[model samples]
Target: MNHPLTDVTRTLGGIAYGGDYNPEQWPREVWREDVRLMREAGVNLVTVGVFSWSRIQPRPGTYDWSLLDEVLDLLHAHGIAVDLATATAAPPPWFTRQHPDARPVTASGTRLAHGSRQVFCPSSPAYAEAADALVTALAARYGDHPALVVWHVHNEWGNHNALCYCDTSADAFRSWLRERYKNLDALNDVWGTDFWSQRYGDWEEIDPPRDTTAFRNPGQELDYHRFCSDALLTRHRAETTILRRIAPRVPITTNVMGTLEKKVDGYAFAAECDLVSVDHYLPAADPDGHIDLALNADLARGMARGRPWLLMEHSTSAVNWQPVNVAKQPGEMRRNSLAHLARGADGLMFFQWRQSRVGAEKWHSAMLPHAGTEGRVWKEAKALGAELAALREVTGSRVHGDVAMLFDWHTWWALELQARPSDQTRYLDAVRDWYEALWTLNITCDLVPPDADLTGYRAVVAPSLYLLSDHDADNLSRYVDQGGHLAVGCFSGVVDEYDRVHLGGNPGALREVLGLVADEYLPLRTQDHALLEDGTRVRQWVERVETRGCTPVLRFADTTDGGPAHGGPAVTRHSFGRGTAWYTATRLPVTALREVLRTLCAQAGAHPVVDAPPGLEAVRRTGEEHAYLFLINHTLDTAHVSVTGVGVAGAEITDGRVVVPPGDVVVVREDLTIAPA
Candidate 1:
């Protein structure tokens, strides 16, 4: 499980505890003050040179390294390691002026001008060539620098220009399709071009799926998304190849905006990185934002295959992008940082070190806010850094859990197409609901892909998986047959990978495994409600299900017309092979869903780290010789959790008996014990 970038010697202080440092924006004298303040705050690392393309390469073929050398040398003198960026995220004005064709074109056919970051088309040959040259030069210059530990290749790909429909992109897309389909006939059949007279007789006849009169071809759109992802990956690989060639010992990575970003596949992108890194931001106004943050962290760890990942960027307080920017309350920042560490993040960094004085993000919170070092934000940042340094034993740990929730980018894309069963059906919302229910029960779960290995999990939950490939369907079936418990939501297994409905029945390929057939989909309006067998009211959707060998776990109330759906199965359980599958026919209320999940976890013999009270979060991370338990209290009142089975002889428990105050964390370290069966 050891990655090239995770070695203790390669990292700073065994844990990175700084943020993005842009000393280039400040005066030379300010750089000395910045380094001094960084050391005082216990910062061991900083990401430098991001968004400096214009400064580094003011004009094409004219390079300046004076400022960069000064900054790197200053950081090295202060014992601060650098996560060096390639400075290719935003092209300089000169490059764009020289290559006008590099501008990205939107789906509306309007070519975007070059005033913003990521304005260059991903498939533009001129842009790619320019970027490659810059990256090569950077690697050749600083690949062996003493301050460099990690190479950050371009910031957040596909953030702004994920897709481009210009002629250059169209040609690249056509070439991509040619490689995939090999012939026009194969492409026609897969795309279902026979419908709507959209069949293409020649590869040259196709173009990017621009804004259309009606709905665009779903298959074509899906393929276009795939092409866009590949195009960006191509750019990433080019830079990574050059970096690896020059800095053979250094690790290269790019920050991924996890689940929040829908354009790129995280698993595929993680494959290109030496280590998985993610930028996670939470809505400051949402009361349930912590649950979403935990879910995203779990997904990042899963992307790293259960190994520790890097928390590349988060805010010290309120982010400026939201409609209402609310700063974090006292103790909230430390709680957020520990939550990520509890979920298997090896390093914790923020979006920035010092607050920017200008630009769109001038209002964004940073470690050192506009109020200076005397501010509460800076005080909290220093405290958190010291705490993280004290808990160095928790670095490079793994999180163990027996429950998993399935997440797939392709399914997310197809489920939310323009035409769908219900407008209330949001992919992330539904998944978050189930994940939050489990969170309340103190049951930890991994966010896994549909095709991930299921043998290690005692139970799996698939929420609103509308699209399924035959391979994934078979994999789930095999998992159920081999003594795995599964809970599938309504509207699942309804379509193939191409967004085409399965012909046989709803939940077509999974009928045998589920032991039920859905005859019709009943999408209720926003305010509509239906009664479950337990007298629990549900809403938004219901399935008219007929059981073959499945036993009804819940039934719907009688309909107004007394149709066949009246008193039909609302939830069913089938005993398949040595395991079982539970199907939820509608979206149940929170209380009802929690009860159902509790029952399922009991049946699967899944146990939480400790029996925690409400509003208290419990998670465990296991290192080579010890298991660290984190108990965080999100409520205003103090919360106490039992530590009977959580600790071993001679164990150290911080703050005594896992008692956590409001918005505080308690860490308990014990000898590693075997997980309960």
Candidate 2:
């Protein structure tokens, strides 16, 4: 499948830039003004008809093409390409009323009312048929439209209604289990149902892990999560099948919420898309949201298998959903957008072009805010559009990473079950902690799956990988044996894919490779802390480690002071085969973690792209002709980076340095002929 970036660059002649265009929300006359503004802002592409199901199909069988036809024609006439949606994201009221069985039910057996979007059950046959019928009609109508460049299957799958515990979904789950396990005996053995006397004699006796009195079966809960994700994928594939049959040439995609999202498995979702597209909104309350943004961009690019992906949706300013919606500063939005581009986003877009007037998201930031063209958001959008227009040559380029960070949704699900270590130990927090450590060092890294090929990466880091399959464990062992560096964080490799224990000490799978035996887990109490030998602060979790052959680099502080932790290794390094494996038995602060990773990376030959200050982010994208070096200055003061290339502003006389203003971005096109070592 061809990536949308490559296709958009070929057909539209530059990077794709635009936002969602909802013509149904406004009068026809307002659309002309919208297009005029879009052209002024340098938008070359816009998504249409995402939430227009009710507008398109008011009744069960009736169709209205007047509004969508005019919208597409007008966009084409204005030289703007269209990312036409399947319009199945939200079903109309009439259809829901007719097929009430398709309505989603809660885990407690309550049928949810259809007032919000994505309210239909994912496994409901009626819902699938209805969605497919709508998708078929849309594809058959606009499959060959001149303005159509991409097929957006559905909007943010599993965002609102991820799992449906209704009977319809129950039947589908039973069928899926039958196909997966082949028989009740296999299912029982895998689920470890004998412990709770929950073993099923017949497939019909099974149900989803609903709200039970006691702790539900971890195995069943984990499988239910997997089933829900796959059910959503099945619906997505159904829509894509019809689109492929009708418009095989157009690239198909659905936006995925990156690392922070725990519902859908991003790896599975990425495989289904022709190209990866993601929707990321900044953490409104966090002081360091940009770090989260960088993690998301890296994860999205990783899902694309290192191919250039698209920024499908973001906010121009404050999103309406946060507890206290704080607006973006003067240049924050620009920095945010360019930051994604610097990572690997070939295209940039927003949630909306024009802000809504009478919807739940009316206050959500958009290209055209409620204050109209006179607002600061509008000006920044225009400036960013022009900047993107100039950087068209960077499209289809690749961002190469020096290290690979392992992330898995299944591990996330299994690790955070009801009964585990302290709830303070979170899966995403561990991933982010390690990622931030790498990011702070200016070390470019790829977010990869556990079983990914680690031949090229100099170092691989696995954080909070609590669930491990035998195949993936062997893959990691093989990677380390082949002279690849491996760093295993705490609570990793503790359980198999069935959510059952490894039947030995903690971190069971990689214990042999790590050359250590974890005798017990020591998750800290709330507000408690532990200290390393060198006074490095550790918190949340720790492990009592007994090294077999590896040497301990950091151990618990002595017991004379009487702290929460007294002895044993906090971190260890094992020389295995031709490579090295590092183990972190306790959670270290970002500063401490960075130093540890820095040491490992230096030994493994994984260095930074450029040695600049901590706050200045540097990433390079290489193409056939040139290599574009993107520098984002997130610090309070200006930064002087050492580099020699043609600036985006066409500045040529380089004195081996580029000065980036605070909270700003700089892109320099270097010669690709001088290949990177």
By TM-score, the best candidate is: 2
- Name the TM-score of candidate 1: 0.96
lDDT (Cα) of model 2: 0.89
Task: List residue ranges in candidate 1 displaced over 4 A.
Answer: 8-10, 559-564, 644-656, 673-677
- Sliding window of 10 residues with minimal summed lDDT for model 2: 558-567
| Model 1 pairs in collision | none
State TM-scores per candidate. 0.96, 0.98
lDDT by residue (tens digit), candidate 1, 18-65: 999988777899888899999998888899998998888888888898
RMSD of 1: 2.4
Per-model CA lDDT versus the true structure? 0.86, 0.89
- lDDT tens string, model 2, 289-324? 999999999999889999999899999999998899
Evaluated against the true structure, the overall lDDT of model 1 is 0.86
